[model samples]
Target chain A: DQQVKQNSPSLSVQEGRISILNCDYTNSMFDYFLWYKKYPAEGPTFLISISSIKDKNEDGRFTVFLNKSAKHLSLHIVPSQPGDSAVYFCAANPGNTPLVFGKGTRLSVIA
Target chain B: NAGVTQTPKFRILKIGQSMTLQCAQDMNHNYMYWYRQDPGMGLKLIYYSVGAGITDKGEVPNGYNVSRSTTEDFPLRLELAAPSQTSVYFCASSYRRETGNEQFFGPGTRLTVL
Candidate 1:
């Protein structure tokens, strides 16, 4: 069974619009969550992360929201640009354990 | 610094063949991990090492073995390759675990088994 799940396989957004990607987890032991963006033929790069203690964290145009009670998280990108197109993976880690990843969601930003 | 490096960007293996995928990191990290990503899927851990001489299996460790004789190197061995083993493999290193520390990943190695 998958502990973390990205139900949406793909998401498309127009330039200058907001994009949201959602993820859910079945395990309550996860304390930290992260997002990674991967371009074709390259390794996934770190995007942003949020701790279970906080409800939201923002960096520039990227924002991550965490809801511990719901066991859910979402990544938001404001004014999405074409350069933001890539595969995004949601990952979570329990204390003192390795990360568990969900199936990635492919984001397409049309300019 | 070359944070992490993997050899043989792409390879093709025949059934029953054996090979070792080499991974090295220059960041002097205490943690190293190996993962495999199938097409359109997220990465699944194969093996990991906390430090030199300390290695452990991950979610998917069947048909694979690993060794960490030194801090800078971790090698994954595939014994008796099978068709189901085809996938892209990645190597990553982090300063620590469960600290929200981002992992630095190397260019992946794509392998196909016939």
Candidate 2:
């Protein structure tokens, strides 16, 4: 069963616009959530993460908001750039257990 | 420093063949993990190691073996290749920090079985 899910397979946005990606989880025990971006033929790179204790975290242009009650999380990129185009995967770790990942959302930024 | 390194970027194996995928990390992270990714699917954990000589199976560990002889190396072995095993494999490592721990991944190894 897929504990973590990213329902949107693809998202497109204009450059310099805000891009929002959403994720949902079924396992309530997950305490840590992370987002990774991957390019073609390359391994995924870490982007941003949020702890269960905090509802929001921001790093540079990327921000992650978590809603514990709804079991949903989202990543927002301000003034999205063309370089931001890639597949983003949402992952969660439940109390020291191995991380579970979502299928991923492909983001395309049109210049 | 090369954070995580995986050799044999691409490989093709016949059914019943066996091979070892090499993974090495220069970051000196104590936690290492192996995951496989299929098309339109997220990564699935195959195995993991907390430290030297400490190994455990993850979500999808069947037909696989692993050993941690040193902190820098963690290799995954496929006893017998199957068509279902064809996928892109990634090796990752993370520090022991309680918070803000981010996993660094290698370029990944793509394996195909016929």
Candidate 3:
């Protein structure tokens, strides 16, 4: 069974608008969640993360909100830009273990 | 620092052939990992090591092997390549600290088996 899931295979948004990507997990043991962004032919890069203890974390135009009770998390990108187009992967782990990654959501920001 | 790097960015192997994917890190990290991403699928852990001389299996360890003899290098070997083994391989390194175990990744190696 998949511990982490990203139901949407892709999403598109207009530049300067808000883009929301969602993720869900079935593993309750997961205490830490993270988002990674990847471009074609490139490795994934760390974006943002949230601990189960907190409900939200933000960095500049990117914000990650976690609803532990719902086993759901969403990544919000405000003023989305063309540069933000890429594949976004949601990952989670139970503290120090290896992370379990979701299938990924391809985000396209149109200019 | 170069962070994490993988060699032979792309490769094609015939059935029954064997090859090794090289991974190296310049950050002197204690934790190193190898993951494979199949088409339309998330990355799956194949193997990992916490330190030199200590290696462990991950979610998908079949048809693959790994060794970490030094802090800077971790190599994964595939024996008798098969079509199912075709995928993009990624190498990552990280320090086990309070920084959320954020990992640094290499560009990745794409392998195709015929």
Candidate 4:
């Protein structure tokens, strides 16, 4: 069974618009969640992360919202740029354990 | 610092061939991980090491082996490669396993087993 899930396979948004990517997890033990972005032929890079203690965290144009009760999380990128186009992966970690990742969502920003 | 480095950006192997994927990090991290990603799939952990001489298996460890003799190097070995082992493999390292210690990744190695 997949502990973490990204139901959407792809998302598209126009430049300067808001792009929202959603993820869900079945295991409540997960306390730390992170997002990684990957370009073709390259390794994934850390984008943002949120802890269970807070409901929301924002960094510039990027914001991550976590709904603990619903076991759901979403990443929002405002004024999305074409450079933001990439595969986005959601990962969850339970304390010191290795993270469980969800199938990625490919995001495309149309210029 | 070369945060992390992996050898042979791409490779092709026959059914019974064997090879080693090399990984090294200059960050002096204590935690290192190996992951494989199939097309349209999330990365799957194959093995990890918390420190030199301390290695453990992760979600998918079959058909692969790893060794960490020093803080800077970790290599993965594939014996008798099979088609199922074909995927892009990544090497990552982190300072430690704190709640949110982000991992640094190396350029992946793409392997094709026929």
lDDT of 2 by residue, B11-88 (tens): 999999999999999988999999999998888899999999999989999999999999999999998899999999
lDDT of 2 by residue, A61-89 (tens): 99999999999999999989999999999
Native contacts retained per candidate? Answer: 0.66, 0.66, 0.68, 0.70
**lDDT per residue (tens digit) for residues A1-111 in model 4:** 999999999999999999999999999988789999999999999999999888998989899999999999999999899999999999997778677889999999999
| TM-scores of all candidate predictions against the true structure | 0.97, 0.96, 0.97, 0.97
Ten residues in a row with the worst lDDT in model 3 chain B?
Answer: B94-103
Best by DockQ: 3
Q: Give the TM-score of candidate 2.
A: 0.96
| Better-scoring candidate (TM-score), 2 or 4 | 4
DockQ of each: 0.74, 0.72, 0.77, 0.76
- State in Å the error of residue A65, model 4: 0.3
Q: Give the 10-residue window scoring lowest on summed lDDT in candidate 2 chain A.
A: A92-101
- In model 2, pairs of residues that clash are none
Q: What is the DockQ of candidate 3?
A: 0.77
Positional deviation of residue A91's Cα in model 4 after best superposition, in angstroms: 0.8
Count of clashing pairs, candidate 4:
0
Q: Which is superior by lDDT, 1 or 3?
A: 3
Q: Report the CA-based lDDT of candidate 4 relative to the real structure.
A: 0.94
Native A-B contacts reproduced, model 4: 0.70
Error of 3 at A107 (Å): 0.4
